[model samples]
Target: MTHALVDSQSLPAELRPYLDGLVRRTLAVCGRHLVSVFAVGSIALQDYRHGRSDVDVTVVADPLIPARALRELAESLAHPALPCPAAGLELVVYGADFVGRPCGAAGYLMDLNTGPMLPNRVSFDPADSADFWYVIDRSIAHQAGRLLYGTAVRQVLAASSERDLYAAMQASVREHAGGEGHLGDNRVLNGCRTVAFCRTGRWLAKREAAQMIATSEQEFRPLIETALHSFQHPRSEALPLPSNDVRTFLAWVGERVDEAATHAGIGDPGSGTYPDG
Candidate 1:
């Protein structure tokens, strides 16, 4: 049982070999249980930066795949085994039954984070506390995911509800506000993306959304520019981001999302327990 990988022609030349290796390795590990493979995030959105971005991939496997097979698959795809072209690979394998389901309801079988920029983690629990990010990523996938192999994206993935997206946005903003993660540039750009999505009902690339926000939000232009510069030149010596200002910007964006959600009658912002990653 072999499946042809598709849609690599539109990807950057440097990424083709890496993606080919991923698909081939995945097929070899999962064998007949593999259903579909989707390239999401930076690669899918055409915003990939050689040294900055991670290759975000989502694989849908038959629910019957054995635990041993998943462990083998994870080991095979870990950084050193199959070198990643980008910073790392963020791979999540979900059961076929979970692909088209709603956010909270769709639990993944394996969430493997491997790369230079990220700490390696291999989780098989469906009840993992990182649903906040996973849910948002799934929503993005529904919009811009590129099918690298197996079935078409739309056939296996479903779009997230406006309310769920709004909630996830709020959770993300709250997490950043509480100083949970680093990478100040990513923090600023993520705030921009969240606000843009809330207003336009579309997911824009991090830099695209930051650029869009910069044009209209004059006060935040400097901060947005700083983020853009750091993202574009990941290897360059960069000044630490101003923590106070970043928090302010995120709070402001959270307010905007809240306002939009209220106007649309999207229910309580605190209605669900969305633990941050």
Candidate 2:
């Protein structure tokens, strides 16, 4: 099995053992088919909190990997089999073919969610309904993902267009406002990040984004500070987040994203896939 050089010194000390085990287990299951394994989200952005954030991973496999191998991989990586050190493990596997192509949408071979307080899900559908999150994730992965075991991320993953990112941000805001996907401090932080992304096309950590927004938009400083505190102290008995205020903030963020999109001449955010270029 070919392996890529990873600068272990750069990663968090707490994550090393778990990541080592993950790579070994994945190699055992996928063998020669494994192309790359990289981490995105907070871990890549250098904002990982042991008890608060999940280890978001994207694994690429050769296009012809068999169904049985996929199943085995899921079972092998599930919590307890290879215990997660963090809150959970959110891992997605995609065929190399899919990553190499320029088409839109999240095409995956398997999506595994396992660890404490997380649902034990193993989905194999390539056309999963939650396309927005995956699309944004791929963009983040391309821009800032930390390689664990594989070829360089940029060389493998196709770059998502600004249009698709704006569409995804819009979908994410809608979900948060409707109380569908993320909740509590996560909802607030997500909104902060979305607003930051709209202004500058860079993805910043939740804390950094919230702090940045709080500086200019002094009116929302209290809300942003509360979310930051809550995120850092996950186990603390914090008061319930102000739901109405959060919703209002998310709606405002949606407006900002729309204005940014219009200014960029990206047109209205739509649900369908657009060209990757």
**For model 1, how does the per-residue alpha-carbon lDDT over 1-277 read when each residue is reduced to its tens digit?**
3335696678878788888889999999999999999898998778998888889999999999999999999999998788887888999999888877776433889999997767788999967655678878898888999889998888888777777777777878888776665578888899999888877888899999999999999999999999898887764344468888888888788788778888889865545332222
Sequence-dependent TM-score of model 1: 0.93
Clashing pairs in 1: none
Candidate 1 lDDT (Cα, 0 to 1): 0.83
What TM-score would every model get versus the actual structure? 0.93, 0.93
Question: What's the C-alpha lDDT at position 189 in model 2?
Answer: 87
lDDT of 2 by residue, 7-82 (tens): 6667788888888789888988999999999999998899999887899999999989999999999999999889
Count the clashes in each prediction: 0, 0
